[model samples]
Target: MLEIITNNRKKATLKYVRAFLFFSLILLILFMLFITGVVIYAKSKGAPPLAVPQSTLIYASDDSLIGETHYGEKRYWVPLDEISPAVVEATLSIEDRGFYSHHGFDYKRIVGAILADIKARAKVQGASTITQQYARNLFLTHDKTWHRKITEALYTVRLELNYTKEEILEGYLNTIYYGHGAYGIEAAANYYFGKHAKDLTISEAALLAGIPKGPTHYSPKVNEDGAKNRQQLILSAMVENDYLTKPELETISSQELNYTFGSTKERPVIAPYFQDEVKRLLASKLKLDQETINTSGLRVFTTLDPELQSIAEEQITQTIAKDSEIQVGFIAMDQHTGQVKAMVGGRDYTESPFNRVTQAERQPGSTFKPFLYYAALEKGFTPSTLMRSEVTAFTFDDGRERYVPHNFNNYYANDKITLAQAIALSDNVYAVKTHIFLGQDVLVNTAKKLGITSQLASVPSLALGTSTVKVQDMATAYSTIANGGVKQEPLLIEKVLNHKGEVIYESTPVKKQVLKPEEAFVTTHLLTGIFDEKLNNYTRVTGRTVMDQLTRHYAGKTGTTRTDSWMIGYSPQLVSAVWTGYDRDKTIDLTAEKTYAKEIWASFMEKAHEDLPVLPFRAPEGVVAVQVDPDSGLLATKKCSEKARLTYYVKGTEPTESCIGKAEITNEEAPKEADEEEKKGWFKRIWDWF
Candidate 1:
């Protein structure tokens, strides 16, 4: 009976052994087939299906960092040589102890992880080695499902078969994600330690290595205690792997490392609106693919002046009442090169991301008259040409309709006014008559020739700038005038380079001599008359309100509508345009809101030109400045009024005669002895400018 029982036990043990051997052989065959299929697919497809995404960095013209643009993952790629050895060792120890030894997976480790998952009744434990984890990150998602698991396994086998172990490791280090918009070890090191990846110490390396397990939990900025706990585990793993000694581990454990994020230090974008415009230009004007801009790791060198950009932002915030709902758009450009130097969309980017300078289109008001007057110059009208600025209704469209233009407060000169006086006063009636006499097509064609792309109706009101236009386009047209009538497109980026520092796109200015240099000089001189009180007639000059705030010479124009107030001006070096009003075009009634544009423009232009030389506007050849009487429009002589003004004109266009000598001089019309000295002082200032 005892022999029979023992024989029964032996048969039972043999049956269990047979079943285990059969299953093991089937599993081994299946694994071999999977590896073969993965190798075939990897070879046929060339590289892995995943491409390492890259980040783009933007720099100011001074070669200082401004900001960066990226997709969801912001990665700054670095080679294996750029990474610290401590970081590599620490990462290997904590992430995959047998990374160098295993092909891509560790079978024994997989078994242990499976057992642990089964014990916990959850899919928490993962047996992904460094290569496996990297393969999963590059090729698959983190979802805990059978489909993703199989895909990850396939990619792991493919990576081990096709790439060298070093290559796989380098890619893994570059593709790993850290918290706070940083991906890859280099960006993480710079973000957390304020240093480069190659400069990280052992403690920082260990701390960074532990972040991959759970970025939310192990990030030092979020949870320092949890990060420290995981850092200790990383250190212990390094010790066990022979990367560090027990004594060194203890020393590192007690050491406190400084985290850049833990302090008050912050690195916000220096120029948000400027960088945004750069992005738009890259995609829209340069015809670069948006995807390529966000991922090709472009290095964009722009024309932004950081100091001027700061001043512009400060002016907008400080000049406007903070609690008011008014919005503002401003732009400053290098008139010579057509390079945009500074820009601000609205008061704050956080509150409104809409790019007003580039996107918003509102009525430009009388600011559009420069193009009209420029067109008049292109035609035969000189600065001294006379027109009447009186109230009149014009019949257009074959005299079927009437368009009556009104001046501010219904005030009119009710007499003859020169084209120069008209521009200085922004007289609507004079502008309309000039617009009509020159034929409406001439102004429209002239504006289009300069830079204005917005549609013009060719109606009578077109002279008064009734058409809605972009502030940037208006700036571009004025830049052409400021550049002595040389037309060129506005540019934001100077050059763009690929990740390899190879130039991809470069700007070559295509300037066209659209207007005569002499005519442009005369027009610019006419604009300067706006600030001179000598040109005052029925009303003060449009720029008179803010002229006292200026310390240097400037040629500018002010435009006002029921909803928009504009100030556009330029010196010899820079050109700026400013607009202030409600966003929804509501009527602006406050006296303060009405004057915000000119005040901001005056203060900003002064601060902007403080460091620049006090250079006068250059007068081109054939353009001569002649002293004349404002009332008579003739050469200034003792027979003229007490005030004598210098006005610019083309060589042949100057008045050929002097004012008729007054038979009798009265005290009211004649200057007192002291007033004569004071008048000389004012004329001397103008003489010194020449």
Candidate 2:
């Protein structure tokens, strides 16, 4: 009976063992099928195209790099050979110890991470290998979720299957964020250490490698202590992984590493304001948002002249009061093409990003007078037209108060002054009277035609330049006069190329004849009168300083209001406008000593025209030069005093009548005049003898 029971027990044990084997075989088959499905799915997805955020490069007219615009990620790709071996070792040691040995994921590290998380009762540890990290960075979101994990695993498998270990490491290093607007190992090394990735020391490489775990917390600029701590851990791991000896690790850890603070130092921007203007222009022309402009990897060729831009920025910095709250805006453009050659939007763009050249609108003051004078010229008024410079008041048809205008310092001659003299003297009363006589609507229309798009009040004050306009528009307006009445829209960008260097868009200046050549020439001549020392007393002419420095034939106007001061002028080749004022609408006293606009304008214009030929303003057909009396609009005669000056007039509009001299003896009474002189001489001789 015992033998039989033992045999049955043995049989039962054998049966249990066979059943266990069968179940194990079924489970293995199921696991194999699951793995096969994952592999197939990942293969179908294929390796994601290696896409990295790229920066748009802006180049000056000389083909020098001016600026770069980036999206959220700022990265620069480099080949695997360019990376330092120390950087590779540090990254592998801290990020994934079993990177070379694992297929896609390290199961031992994964199990250890899971146990650690269970002990901590929170998902505080990450077991993502380098491949998994690259997969997430390239294709998956960073959210902590089972779905994202699965997707990351699938992408990791594909990455491992398609790319070599070196390729995977290269992609991983190039895609990791390193804080402070820096992405990728190359950008990180350059930004923080001011050196290339291939030149990184072991300590620097360790610090950079530690940044990927928590870039913000490990940034050396933000938290040096935390970064040092993480760096020490990375160095220790490097030594433990046989990447460095104990003594070598000690020596590297003891060496001090210097770092640069900002990303701009790594990649310098040559013309920030001009670059911004280009971006804005591109945005409008392409119908794309600013984000796309920054991230599209476009190669923008701008119209900016780097030399002129340097001069502009330097002149503005030197001319503005050091301790004052005043701000200045400047812009220079090519008269023929309307290409913006140089621009300084403000004293410092960092303090105020408001681009006064293209955005801010302030009262143009007397700068708006040229348009008014141009309107008068269009209305058959010549430069010699007589206008009253006395104080004048106008009552508006609308229920507003009466508008009374005064000349600067209440110093008008209160006499009949030729339009040329009025322009040279910037007589406010004369301008207002001319505006009213020619019709206010005419001046407004003329301003709009000249490219002053800012709103202008229809009141008579518009003649006195109470209308607000941008410096860019003012520059364009003067450029129109310089370009022989052809108004070309201001252009900032020359051409835009895609990442592959294909021309995507190019600028063709929008141009139209806004004024007759004769009219524009007459107006330009009148503007030149402002710099005439003889026409003015050489004292109060607003553009006298510019005239003193500039040798070329140019025309300009100086404008001063309670809150703004401007010097907008142009040569036949270049046109520029300089505006100085406070950012807030507070009254600023722009005395001769405080008027930086004219000073800066003179400095920049003189430097800009240094290499160009001295070209005189050519008078177009139908425009004639004639001498005229200062007090009368008529032509000059021998009887007229020396105040008579040469003036330009549109043909048929010149003064036809000659000036009549003061009352005196006529030619018929020449003999009687001689007898009177003889009698006076005899009487004087007798008195002297007595």
Candidate 1 per-residue lDDT over residues 1-690, each given as its tens digit: 999999999999999888888888888899999768777886776657446678888989899878877766667777789899999999989888787789999998899999999999998787879988898778777888999988787788778878888888988888898898778898899789988889999999999999988899999999999999999999999999999999999999999989886132257667687788899889977688888888877889999999999898888888999899999999999889998889998888888989888888899999999889988887778777777778888999998999999999999988777778889998998888888888999889988888887888888899998899998998998888988989888888889988656898998989898888888888898899889888889998999889889988899999999999999999998999999998998988999999999999898899998899998998988988888877567788877767678888878888877865556556676656457657677655442221
Indicate which candidate wins on lDDT.
1
Give the winner by TM-score.
1
Ten contiguous residues with the weakest lDDT in model 1: 681-690
Query: What TM-score would every model get versus the actual structure?
Result: 0.79, 0.70
Backbone clash count for every predicted candidate, in the order shown: 0, 0
Q: List the residue pairs that clash in candidate 1.
A: none
**Could you give the C-alpha RMSD of every candidate to the true structure, in order shown?**
8.2, 9.4
Cα error, residue 389 of model 1, in Å, equals 3.5
Model 2 CA lDDT for position 92: 93
Over 4 Å off, model 2: 1-74, 77-133, 141-149, 156-173, 177-181, 192-306, 348-351, 392-404, 413-415, 494-508, 537-540, 583-585, 620-647, 651-690
lDDT of each: 0.86, 0.84
